[model samples]
Target: MIDNGDDSLIFAPENGKTAEKVQEEYWKVLIVDDEPDVHSTTKLVLEDFSFEDKGLKFISAYSAKEAMEILNNQKDIAVILLDVVMESNSAGLQLAKIIRNEMGNRFSRIILRTGQPGEAPEKKVIAEYDINDYKNKAELTSQQLYTSMFSALRSYRDLKIINKNSEGLKQIINSTANLFQRQNVEQLAQGVLTQVVSILGLENSYYVSTSGFTAAQTSDSDFRIIAATGRFTKCIGTKVEDCTPIPADIVPYLQEAISKEKSGFIDTHYVGYFPTMKDKIHLLFIEDCSKDLGPEIENLLTIFNHNAGIAFDNVILNKEIHDTQIDIIYHLGEVVENRSKETAYHVKRVSEYTYTLAREMGFSEEESQLFKMASPMHDIGKIGIADSILLKPERLDHDELNIMRTHTEIGYNMLKSSSRPLLQTSAVIARDHHEYWDGSGYPRGLKGEDIHPAARIVCLADVYDALGSKRVYKEAWKEEDVLTFVRENRGKMFDPKVVDALFTAYERISRIKERFKDPE
Candidate 1:
């Protein structure tokens, strides 16, 4: 430990103290003074001084202008010992002011040294220059010089550490914001990995997060390749099984951490290790082949492990919610199937058919998907009808048929007024599907121009599905027969424009039929 008045320069101290060792561990210090004796004297005092196991390396500059040259070229200079009365009476003071106020050398500690105390008063010089220390050259004994150098060096080291951490924190915050903006889990995972690698200063890497379906009973882990920053041959979507096995070097550590659900850091650069996540521990892998990582990279890995796990949980929850909604819709479609002898595949086929027709009609992809989902609910009102009327093989009497016709009104009443896309389209179909272009049908009896386009489109899908499918009351018709029936009814039972659109979509309709073919 070296002491300089109120300041202490105690470096933790490496195994040995030497100028080479100090230069290797700490930022270089430059001394600017006019006197040749001061440079030699200062070096002798600090030759053995070590701060935090690091000794200080010193460079000497004769004047303020010389110091600026050194400052301009040597970015590693962390601190400077300056004299206030070099060249001109106040040149050192002016240089100190310029270094701080103009050059923006905030990180380098500046100590102003002067021998002619009368030329510039201590109080005035201290106020004018943003120097860390003010000292009379004559008063700075060997011990005092050693102590001042150590204290200034320590402050410089601490400031550098603080700045690096601040930059890392900023990177983390920006990456977290990006993660939040992502709509898919892959994107979120990518953001997390990118931030982590950057903060740790890793060269290039990839991240994988693994989790299970349930908290306790997950099968083979679900792996998500969240982020990749380096030039790896594998793509982001590549599964764990597709990649080469974990390198023999990292496999054991990874397996142990994964089994215990504990986080760990590895030193291998060629292959990265992460535990397989079953129900709990979400695994992450990073392939960083760079040679620069040591304890700093390990520190980052520890920080990232927990953050990434939480992110994976959020992604899984979102996926589960999306899948649950689809399952509920599927079961609801099944309920419609129970109302008639139509299989659940019938609803699927009609949705596909509707999507194809909408696509052929030049609708946007979003509208086509909406039509696909809504088309399944076109017959949803049949759920309200009795099996006796729905399954009757014989022709109904006029009154029985009238009650059956009320199914359209029932379907409309059940779905109308709801704001959901599926319900809204179903409502339109239920209300106007039976209406003729000539205004000779039931419900609202809307005419051609007045009918909602959604209803008109579904009318074609419903009729085509009905004609092509075998039902309790009617056998399935041949493709040619169905086309003839549709052509015969065009402009009478169906909208003429819609019939024209349907004819254009015959190829698409056939493809939908082939794609969603029934198992039975």
Candidate 2:
């Protein structure tokens, strides 16, 4: 549309001829010739030219210096109609070097049009420089110019596509890696939306899924936005019908994809369909697509979407497995606690405290979680003790106390045969949770570093909780007294580091008792 510099000139299609409608996209053509008449004549010849349903946008520069300014500002110029001997005998030839090497634009096609063939021979120009085609000014015709443009524009278009897709594939591979690191379905859904936006080079995206994990209903109306990016961030948790930013008409097509369980490009937008194993559905929506955006993106999205669905399903299934395992451990612990009329929440409180203390000591979350799970079964051996010894109202005599201590060995035997890591961990915890740090007090009398770190951590957590809780024979000690006792027995009764961690995290870990409180 812009024809020249400083002076303005506009061209319109002739009225009698069947004209091409104005296209949204244009192939930029830069005309670099110092002669004013040459600029005028070249525009007249290529004035009606169109390539790939797009018209030409001509940029005029009178010298090599002026052309450099235009090239510096505009990045997507498709063709340069360069003239030799502009400012010098080899101005156009040198400009070609700048365009290829200094400017670093490899996609733009350059065709040399020179009046002085003697100044720069066609053979030498084509062989030395990166120029695509060389034309003698006297023999160049209107039809020849058109033919040259068709070849140049098509090559530029294809080069750009190959580069864009290569970059897009790199983004998808990294995005899929990020998706796998997410710990929950919500995080994976958000990751899917982010990666899709990055691949498509769009700014906005959102994920929609059924509200319940076990979705019994399937309809466009049932989908709610689970995650979103950009201006749509506030739309999360909103029903698709209520989200105003989303085009309302796109809903039916989304339902169609979900109904058919397919993911592909729609008429204008990219629709992502993810059906989870829990009978749930997740859909990703990318907005404001380009005319060139189509099946080219489908291949990249297919690889990324496949990983997204698997990641979401894995998180959901792993969470279900963890929940079921925790339920069984608590039920079994609660059984042992009831035999001696202990607080049902006692096992839960100690479990929370053990997790808090282990993490405070710089343990990994995975290791700390194992401690949380294993702490509930620490008193499991008490199940083997007689009610007369286990439930005695008063302090047990020496013989009766020794019988009670055998319960730890009994619990160890109960779980020691299992091959599972969790059960084997629980067996060690049940056996050593009662051991003293100084090699003086336990069925095993294990000393110092000889105790398993998990058992050492639970030992401190168990006694700290027991001292603060009320028993049938002894009243509950105050917080001040409990702290004083733990501080004084730092190495005598507990692992010194675990004792220190408990004190450092006393405010946070002590609150666990308040949360999982003994029921009145």
Candidate 3:
């Protein structure tokens, strides 16, 4: 496919000498004529040919089979001079179709030629097959062939630039669309590295910072690495200055990018400067000494960084909103806990438990965050209950118990009016968390799979956290006893799948419990 990813018009690196190979690269031309005389004559005519300062390098193919082999191995062949009657009358035309359709070689320009004009397809058929030019062997003088080669190489160069621009734009759009999918700054940083390396036509790149998404013209400590990939994975949380002896020293490039406030290549490494709305530059540094950078690649990188700068602003704003939302949920959960004289960590432990279980059950990381954020509001309806009912030190009378159960419905009513996803989720959990797997639960008495999966997960999480903590009517149960009861009640009081997820992640659950324990 001619490596049209804005990589050089020449060959890619082989044997780890990419820089050297690119420095001495030529415009590769393949001669697919059966006659040895045609090969010798073509090479002789173009032996001194240089288009845009790149001389022609000839590859000979005596048959279509050999041509296909050369095309498959050589990704950067710029021009194919094909004979229409090499293997068959339509062999050259068929090869052109395969190159364009099956092999996806859009960047290479195909020129068809034949000694016998009557045996060749018409000009219309040749154009249909995407052959750039048709030439009769007798009429193609050296001057005429030179003119054709000049036009073909120019077209090839334009196509490579256009392909690079389109691919870069696509990557920018994809990266911006994925901003909401990132769970943290570290993930966002990693995504930037992956996308940039792809757009720049390189194999691998790594490193991004959380604390110092700052402009490169600052202190070296400002660049504390948060996300690291490729060979730099071990550098996470380390400063760029501290990343010495790793082969590429990026501190200088970082400074250069921010000073220019533009994306550019320095000593073959690509350094991008993305300034946010806050008047700070969030630098992206990548090491690729192999790629041949031209004005087309530089322009593409500039266009991408413009979009990436905006993405940086959006990601930061989104992160702030996410943190604020979680804080509000925690505080709200604490209010309900305080009213019932329970430890604030009750809600904390429950949220983490739901998150852990959701992940262990194969829910995505984003879905698991929703579980963590909304589970704390499971008891939000208790805010409407009388203190006498909520904080009762003794078993409630049947009428009082029935009133206590109404807290679920009250909580649902409080949050169900809001259109937000988190609140809507909280409403579902508040109403249905008491519902059981065996159709023997409260409020609407919804059973089994009829319960919302979020609520079902919350139901099990609530029971587990509550059982292990001291309350007005009960002392904290032993951890072993808690596990036994949970397992025994599976498919009865709790969802069996959720219970199983807990067992599968017992050590993690235990750690969450210990981290948020009530003060002795």
Candidate 4:
């Protein structure tokens, strides 16, 4: 250890590695004294001084104007040794004002070194200017200078750490705010990866892997690259070991973190483990972080991991609730179908057909899933119709038929009062699914675009399923017969665009029919 007086010490590397192989980071010090001897003497005395595994890198400026230029270019200068009597008697004072006010650099510790103490007295300069310390060149000995440098460097280091932590906290807040807007697990996972990287300042060369099971049960089959940035973008959705050009040892490190349920660091790479509430595991891998993995950064990672896991858990819980609601809707629709002497598969087949047609019509995956969930409820109004009219063995008379048509209005009234989106959509399908493209065929006869697009798509899907399935009043029609009816009714009974989408997805629709065949 090299002593800098007053018991302060700087320890050397224990491994005794060559200087060239072990690159040393340094604390930057700017010496802004007009006297050439002061600059040279200060560098000579502090040449061997080191602190916190770093040495001092002295930058020289012969005048205040030159110092300002250097300060403008370099951002990480830790301490400034400024001389009061520069080109002008008050040039150092003026530079201090510019640095604090104009440059907004409040972290770098400034020590005013002056030969003429009377020009700028120590008491007056300390109170008026933002300088941290004042020293007389005549009395400033080698040991005193080392002591002052040590104090200033320590203050600068602490200030920098506080600033970095503040920025990291801001990043975490912003990331979680953005994450709250995501509606699904995949989106939340991606947002968590992005925010973690932002907090750690690792924008480049990172990979995120996830296991859809508990750590104890996690295997290669359960692990997938959920979110990847930079060079690993192509690895998403693939197994970790299957990704090419990956480090051979990364998988083992990831496994260790998962099985142990903890974060791990190996050299410059860090693996963060976040166990979600669903008993699943998410691992974030980053290579070549912009900063060292110090105790402060490690603490920040721990906090981030905890919060991210909770956010992911909330998203998963919401998704499970949403899926359960959809299942309940399907079962309710099945009840209505069974009451009408229709097979339970009629509702399932209608849902599948509507999903296919919605996708073919360029609807987003989420919207298509909504259509699939809402379409099954289309005939729920039929449950309110009189049994004599709904389960009739022969064609209905005009009055009975009119009463039967009111099932659409009955179903709409039943669901329209609810505030849920799925039910609101079901209300629309119930109210307008029977309305025709050309001002005909409904209780209200809402024509053209006046009908909701969701109802329009489900209308064709329901009719297709109904005509192809056996009913109490009629036998199931042939595939060609149903197709001919759909073609004939285009623009007259159904939306022309919806009919076109149906024809486009004819093969997939056939496959759906074969898959969910009615019980014989």
Candidate 5:
């Protein structure tokens, strides 16, 4: 009963009985023998047999060459019944070795049957090849044939189960290593969801959603959906109950999984609970899995959840440290501004302006944040100037102005020694922010592209804020006067590209000024 690559089912007729309808999935049996009578007789005997609610499907091949072709094309052939004497006396034995050693197929059960046992001795053949059983055709009665087949099928089934478990474990191990490479919580959660579907071999059959919240928050409303895939893509950033058209029963199970701090399964669906350090809890939901959740899959999920918990904790801790560093940068910049009789909000305005210009210049979100953090330190060099020159109410002479110009180099020297990334960026901004676009400004006299773009952006932001805000030696200028000066100095005092970005983001620039205005 070989499949001819057509969408039709073929079954051998039993004696005086109509063949039963075949199950959707059946155990495949391949018969490799030179005799036509043996193939017909074997199929006739097993046509009515069923095991584990699955019927038998037989495939026939007359020669060993044809048998190898069938084996190459089909993947799930469970048992192969090979005859000892075929085209040659040793053909069956040779094919058995090829299947196990060369093809690397250890899951299929092979049984050797022969009419002439003297041609190939039983004990020698069994020891030499990887066959599962040896039987003499004369003594193989109907009951003996049934017994032999039942035992072989049982062994084949168990081997498949073991193989599936080994593959699942391998996937989980690889996924854990990949998940650890992500640096933030949102990225880690997305990776975990992708790996869980991959481990089950149901990547396209299931939809995954993950929600996270602080552990102290008990209400379901606090659990925001941080990541969602497939049908739940639009559910991201929404609370669980607010996800419209989601099954009502699934919402309660998600809440239960979080409240109880455990995983829950309903038929093919599952919810995994992971609690991290610092009172953070993550919940993963998988829906519409095409297959039943076996004990093996459940066990794999348990191991995956445990490892993911540690990775999630590391991401949260790293985020906290990052926020603390940014705060330190803001305060250090404010201290320098305060010494020059400038309000703290002046530094805040510059940071926002730099961030806006960076975005307009096509910088990524991460790079824009770096610009915002480093821009505040552009005037840190002013700290080194003495009060006699820095605080003078009148214009400075040549010697005193030259001393004021040395602050750029002084700020660079103060911060250049630090190994931290944020401080290193601040050092560059401090040194080059005073450089002119046309090789006229002091320090390095870096012209055009020689200066870093971050420094170029901060240069405009600093001048704009200083012109608008009142200082110790001058009154605040009108908004029109500042814009006119910026436009007039486009390619001489500042980079033309930076000036263009400033105009493009002028609305946001105005909003930042109003939001952080100094106290009256």
Candidate 6:
């Protein structure tokens, strides 16, 4: 793919003179004239002239109609040397019009050449058609023929480069559209890969991941195939480490490709390396369509490989920044739990239960994650309470309980002003988690549907964990007793809708407790 700002077609400098050998086979040129000598002489004079850095192969046509048939069929032909009086006076001129206007071939350059000066006037003919040059056969000596081809070839090359760049730019713009649609790592990766394959017209791609080392150091040793397209699924889970039976020279070459984050093309195969783990690089091998590995295809492979590397890197950097934010929210909730030793794992258990319940309720992924992370911070205001009140072994008296009730206001105050989603959700949960479903609880005594659904969901998770576990002030209730309390409180203290979902997911909740069970 071409870079956006600079529309330059870069042919790699490393291949040097040998690069010409790769491109020499693809360029096509057509000649249309009645005289056989014109064909023999022209091919002899400029037979070695290579345009667009590729040597041309000539295809001859005796009549104007024959030239049109050849031009319509040969899509990659870059230039045409057309004789004006072939079969008719304006045959070549009419053919140029069809090539430009009818076929819509904006890239192939057309040059008009005539043996008879009287057949068509140069100025009128040149001004009328989309032809690049008008030349007299007698006047076009060996040197002049070379000059005509050189001029036509340069124009054809520039137009093709511009067309390719436009296509690549459109792909890049479309690739970023899915940024707002998905939030998790796997979904995001698929979105990026879908854009990449569509943009490049690739048949398939694969993803690999690894851990334990820095990206550059573990480039060869760490990669393990994690996900793959259907075409390459059989190779999923394969490790890239161990050069062993593989040739030593090929192994080191691949390893170096990973370390520099470079892409390489060998024959019909292409290798794209992406940093998957801090220490690992993933190699995606795409099967070639043409099957014959040529130089032009090799350059195209380089373009895709380079683009995939940048795209993959951007996704990883974004994932890291996002995870860092969730980490801050998680530990902040942990600080609230550290207040009372009996509550050390309270926030963790509540978060797990909340996520499981939201999943059971068929909530959107964004909603479920937001609830899980935000629910744990429900009692964050407890950080402001006195140790004597927070850790008391006896139940609070009336006046002391009134003071304890202020924690809701304190929790809401701590999070209410933030614009971030996690913080905003935290404020909502803090304020309404203590409110009752039947309009009985405080601080605003929000009733029924007045409270946010996020707050209602957290209320169930928080209450369930609170009743089942032993706190500093009470003994752990038996499982049956806890279930009875939740069932009895359904519409009065908890949202009936949430209570129903909780009952449906009881076994999953039991499993969650067992998974994150406190060591005490």
Q: What C-alpha lDDT values do all the predictions have?
A: 0.67, 0.80, 0.78, 0.80, 0.81, 0.70
RMSD of 1: 8.1
What lDDT is obtained when candidate 1 is compared to the true structure? 0.67
As a whole number from 0 to 100, the lDDT of residue 348 in candidate 3 is 92
* lDDT tens readout by residue for model 1, 422-459: 66876777667777777887776788878776667777
Question: Candidate 6 residues 1-520, lDDT tens each?
Answer: 1112343222122222112223535467788987766665556555567764678777889998998889888887888888888778888888888888999888888888887878788888877788888877655555556777888888876786666556555545455545334554445445544444454452112222211111122243565444445444443445434322223344454566666777655454344566553544655544342344344434554565455555556666777887897788778888877766556677888988888888888898788988998887888887888888878888888887877888888999999999989889999898889999998888899999998888888888998888888787787899899899999999999999899889999998998888878777
Q: CA shift at 396, candidate 5, in angstroms?
A: 3.9
Off by over 4 Å in 4: 1-23, 62-66, 84-90, 115-121, 178-182, 202-255, 266-271, 275-292, 353-368, 467-520
Q: What are the per-residue Cα lDDT tens digits for candidate 4 across 126-150?
A: 9999999998876677777888999
Candidate 3 lDDT over residue span 1-520, tens digit each:
0123443122222222112123376899999988876776666556677877888888889999899999999888999999888778878888989999999999999888877788875666665877898887766666767888999999998897777667666766786677546766667666666666666662222222211122222342366666555566667766666664345455777777767867777876767777766665566766654456566656666666776666677877887898999899889899999889887699999999999999999999888888789998999999989988889999999999999999899999999999999899989999999999988999988888899988899998898888888998889898898889998999998888998999999999999988997999
Please give each candidate's TM-score: 0.63, 0.71, 0.81, 0.79, 0.79, 0.66
Better of 3 and 5 by TM-score: 3
Q: How many backbone clashes does candidate 1 have?
A: 7
Q: What pairs collide in candidate 3?
A: none
Best by TM-score: 3
Error of 2 at 481 (Å): 3.6
- TM-score, predicted candidate 3 vs. hidden true structure: 0.81
List model 2 lDDT by residue over 1-520, tens digit each: 1234433333334334233336777888898988776666666757688776688877889999999999999988899989999878889989999999999989999989887899998778888999888887766666677788899999998998887677767777788788888877777778787777666652112232211111112353587777877556677777777777666787776777877888776776667888888787888866555435556676777888888888888988988998899999999999998887886688998899999999999999989999999889999999999999888899999999999999899999999999988899999999999888988878799999999999999888888878888876687799899989988988988889999898899888857878888877
The sequence of per-residue lDDT tens digits that candidate 5 reaches over residues 256-347 is 88778897575566677888776767888787654465677778888888888888887888888988887887888887877777865988
Which regions of candidate 2 fall more than 4 Å away from where they truly are? Answer: 1-24, 33-37, 61-72, 84-98, 101-104, 118-120, 202-224, 230-254, 264-271, 285-292, 324-342, 354-460, 470-475, 478-480, 483-511
